[model samples]
Target: MKNKKWFGLLFFAMFALLLAGCNFNSSEKSDDGTKKSGDEKDGEVAQVLNLSAPADVPTLDSTKAHDAIAFNVLNNVNEGLYRQDESNKSVPALAEKHEMNDDKTVHTFTIRDTTWSNGDPVTAADFEYAWKRVMKENGAYNYMIATAGVKNAEAIMNGEMDAEELGIKATGDNTLEVTLESPNPLFKTLLSFATFLPQNQKFVEEMGDQYALEAENILANGPFKLVSWTQEQGWEMEKNEDYWDTDNVKLEKVNVFVVKDPSSGANLYETGKIDRVKLTSALVDQYKDDKEFENVKDSGIVFLRFNHNNPVLKNVNVRKAINMAIDRNGLTDVILKDGSTPLYGVVAESFYFSPDDKDYRELNGDFNKGTPEEAQEYWEKALAELGQKEVEVSINIADSDEMKKVAEYLQAQLEDNLPGFKLEIKAVPFAQRLEIEKAVEYDLSLSTWGPDYSDPMTYLDMWVKGSSANRMDYHNPKLDALVVAARGETDLEKRYEMLLDIEKILLEEDAAVAPLYQRGSAVLLNEKVKGLVIHPSGADMSYKWAYIEE
Candidate 1:
């Protein structure tokens, strides 16, 4: 498609790069939400940062990490060949230098002289071990390597080949090589994500089941080392002195408070306990005039994922009727009120542009156009075929303050528009919700996906029948074939045309996932909190260059 390597891009969207404030030595919030200062550590002031995570990371094992929180955590703790910079572009990280073959099928990286938190040498073998581990385990993010055009990756995933033959090797202690089936222009960008991060073989083997289970079990090669984790309350990280670029890391410690309630988070911010707080609709209005309010339109879409194993959801008409009954506009404007746009398709607006230089969403247009009358007609057909007058379904959503409101609105909309349809809303912690959804044990679940790389394929690839992230068990021969073709397609225009068809099938014809809204986070941020860059894709945020302006 494009000639640029994986580390380069022709476009970069809006990124939240903030700068301000004096450094704090080690700050903690007491029970009443006031700062507890540790200004002196070993006779010197230790620069500290205060932050927040809405939820705790389910797992730190890079292979099993699927959510933004986990990605954000792993991204801070682990080093890969590259890392995304302040402008949301890929740049060198662990690799001191790199080169790609003339044909673009083979890439090589020279590992920099770095050591893990435990003082073990970081080598190319670590990368090889980590990459193969994901393929062998068939974890959720293994699709990333396949989509990156790694040779034999698809074959291995299909059981046609072994992971050992997956075209990656440790040529030497410091030399790593990767062979791709085709020239994937975004391969470097793909490498920047946590899924591609290296894992220490010895440490992992020693820890066994306990690897990454707690802060002490994990090792850090990047700028931060997770030091403490209290799932509900919060987590903490310290500057990794072992990092190759440790001289540049500013903050001595980073604190992430887990406050699920939006108002509580805002309260924590107002009390000087946290640096940033994600605002709810009410909080957004209250703080709209405040100098701290920021509205960042993300390249992620929050949607209702349909479980295909559920009989009602399996019926195309039923799915179509359900989508039509929900008012996406009302959900975003009234319920969310966070500048989010009603999502009509699975792919978000800021992800990719076609060869004709048109955003995929702009080119594809809205697909959810069914009216109430049409929804009722489809519902009737679904009932007749299923031989049922009433259908009951449960929607599992994360226990976030905003979602609590949205769940009520969804129940009201579906019940009001579709006769005899019952919707039960269930709320759980974000980590638990992921576990339940993986079992395909619910009729539907509220989920969101941000692009791992800036490509339409990132959105389209997961819905394929056997994809690890395809917890829905969705299978369409036509859609499957289109995705397979698009993954390997080198012609930009042709791939664009195919993705257009794929999106239509997914959003309109099959109605696999009910589009909800493209998320826009309105937050209360301290202008003085500098260096932390918020990305539209991949990891949600990066703090490598973070420092207090003071």
Candidate 2:
């Protein structure tokens, strides 16, 4: 996990549609008298869809939400200017009509007539306020605004100008105009992203700090609204009858229960308490032959991030040695039996295709691959360079079952492959792990990144010196320059070539980060759950078009 010419909104939309939609149909059924749908409109088929989540919602605030779980929730509870259809293509939602200039520097949109769950009208001002607020606050993901090529966005982020000068405005009650510093082919794709989703400015101001903290505090303009949410327990959603496209929303309610452990989630599914569950390696083994077993591909990469500030890790050969030592093939084949695969480049496979119509991985073969012999050579050189025979390092990781197992495997691989290497694992809660990484106090950290939109820049730009996601204190001037050029380059081929060069520098030459594997999920979904679109990236899954076929 983890674009085109400056043609305009319609061109962008077409490109998005051509992208491989991640949806895959699967089969399962709960029929032993345990299947229950609380309420139904037809008195036959219940539209309520039950699911299991690896974690609870961290936050529902669209502007601030970062994790997949929270973004998934926000995606359902709110509508932005655009949304992904069942085909996982960008389509207009709140903004019914849109056009961009020939240079793709300016975009104008017509906000559709819609109301929030609280009965307030959804206005063009909502989008403006939300985006400006993001700049003014400069939160963790604020780089995204600048990434969209919004004019003066970086200046505003740097405090050189007010957020009001960030090149977006509500020109009329229903019209929004946005000016971009440069042409962005993926701009329309961002419209469907959670961060770009609009906010009711008046309501947010009224709630203050408590906004989006609970079900009652949040407002919905999409297919569903949060009916109730019990922290660490479960959350429930009901159809938003006030939604602009309510008729197309098939699911009346979606009940998601927090089940952190794969075994626990499987147990709930077996007991008929949940309809969908993800399988761990062991569960995948057991359920491989089951009718409900569906191994879905994911566009996320689990990688090891080296803190460049660390004296030991600062040695490029040491980073390369670490990269070479790990047996990613074995890790994915055995440790992650849910179809995860070894990833050699920063950008995961099946994620981004270039303007020339070649997959990023297909275009750039394995870049940083190394054998055990190579690892030993790099290790010896690193030791001589640092005047050290051995070093002890700790890897910070989230204590999820999958991550813990992977960490253990990595620990064994490093300690065995590189003689005198002492690796320590410090596994903590997911939230705590994030805080630790954000502080840049860890020597090494294992992290996973899902793409926001299908583009090489999504993965390449994170290591651009001062990006918020660059928590490893890693920066390469050459890589930074390439990223900037890639972002602003209007020539698609040149931009794509820059992406290739950036990946070469980051993954091969500098070894800025060690990519481990591309993650895949083995899920058991009830066959009756129709129209569920599991995207490769951006918010994980969508229930807007999902419904219980029972």
Candidate 3:
């Protein structure tokens, strides 16, 4: 997926108006099996939206949710300080009002009087507790470093200080104050992210480790609340009556079923069992001309993460050789025919914004792209340096249908292009694959990252030596310095330049990770479904404003 900033103010205003009419009243079912507005009543199936998920929700814990499926669900069931409107712009959600200092180093938010599903008032302390929890080492939040600019956040995450010493404070029940070590233009947008969503401090303490593990244990302060989650079977979310904007929530219930098979999902959509389904490459061509067919662009990049600690992969020459050998064009155009584009840089296209209104990619063009001969030369040098005739390495990948196809193609490409490298593919389930990455148990893992926000720093800062997402264990003092300097640099042009240089060092000079392609999804949505907002990054889709015409 790729992140695109919201532009054209007139366009967004019109978009908001289009969704403003989405609110549905307590309607009655007509004799023709259709909804009709009438007197308010309970136990009525006036509206219910059905969708299919490729995988089950791995973890609903706000701090631990790293997958798209979990993020989508969280986006609906939780309310943060802010949220993305119909046009992908951050707007106030739980926080009624927010103020930033002139230098943009400090922020103060006034929380609204919103009640949780359990009838408890949501307070500013909830936000403080949630943010502090993520900064602690025991939290293991994957994207904690994204907000490391918060004063003492780095110290808290690195165990240099207690989480209590972190920069956020609850000045009052409704007031939250945050101090940043450096200016961050995207901090408000970061607040709209799932990881930044607040958790009730009292409820968390009561539940302890069992918090967010089951549907019943969780509480919601957003448009919807989880009614049931049956693991692999499915989950049901009903509209939250206690939501501050419950009147704007149209759907009475959103039923999401886990269907791993694309064909099964397509069948469900066709048979009127599901309202939306994503198409596989096999089905993309078949449905491309249909009116309901929609291909959504995302600010996500898929790549190969080389474990720098791995014996054979520890060689820079070997890493570069693997980078040069893979045919990204073939991988995207052939193996992935679902509109995914080849990517040469770790940061996906259209995700970075430049102050001078110039394209960052134009300033710093494509990173290392080498031919077969160049790959062979590096492989030979690597073999000689390591004093090994040939080395066997495993490539861990998700066992999803699309992932399996890509893994097989990569395996063939490496074996054929780099002669001395014996590539072995290990395909595992999506949840197990994340565990393998966390444990650093794979030599080379097929991985993908969607930005937590629309900033270049979101993509660039992950490889800074000690980041939890830096599974490769890549460490370069030069690369680290550039990223750190970029974060504190207030001048937008200079900060972008620093980011470009950082990408050069990681993608070209050191070959810290291999870039493959930027992701795109081909989906079939029932035309009756409206107000379904698609984003370039963060949550893949938002159903807050969604409603069915039927």
**Cα deviation of 35 in candidate 1 (Å)?**
11
Tens-place lDDT digits, model 2, residues 386-446: 9998899999999889999999999999999999899999998887788898899899999
What are the per-residue Cα lDDT tens digits for candidate 1 across 390-430? Answer: 99999999898877787888899889999999999999988
How does each model score on TM-score?
0.91, 0.92, 0.90
RMSD of each: 9.5, 10.2, 8.9
Q: State the displacement of the C-alpha of residue 68, model 3, in Å, after optimal TM-score superposition.
A: 2.0
Query: In candidate 3, which residue pairs get closer than 3 Å at backbone N, Cα or C atoms, i.e. clash?
Result: 1-298, 1-299, 1-300, 2-298, 2-299, 2-300
Off by over 4 Å in 2: 1-43
* lDDT of candidates 1 onward, in order: 0.83, 0.83, 0.80
Assess the local accuracy of residue 23 in candidate 2 as a C-alpha lDDT between 0 and 100.
19
TM-score of model 2 vs. true structure: 0.92
The candidates, ranked best first by lDDT, are 1, 2, 3
Model 2 RMSD in Å is 10.2
Q: Which is the leading candidate under TM-score?
A: 2
Ranking by TM-score: 2, 1, 3
Q: Candidate 3 at 419: error in angstroms? A: 1.2
TM-score of 1: 0.91
- lDDT for residue 126 in candidate 2, whole number 0-100: 91
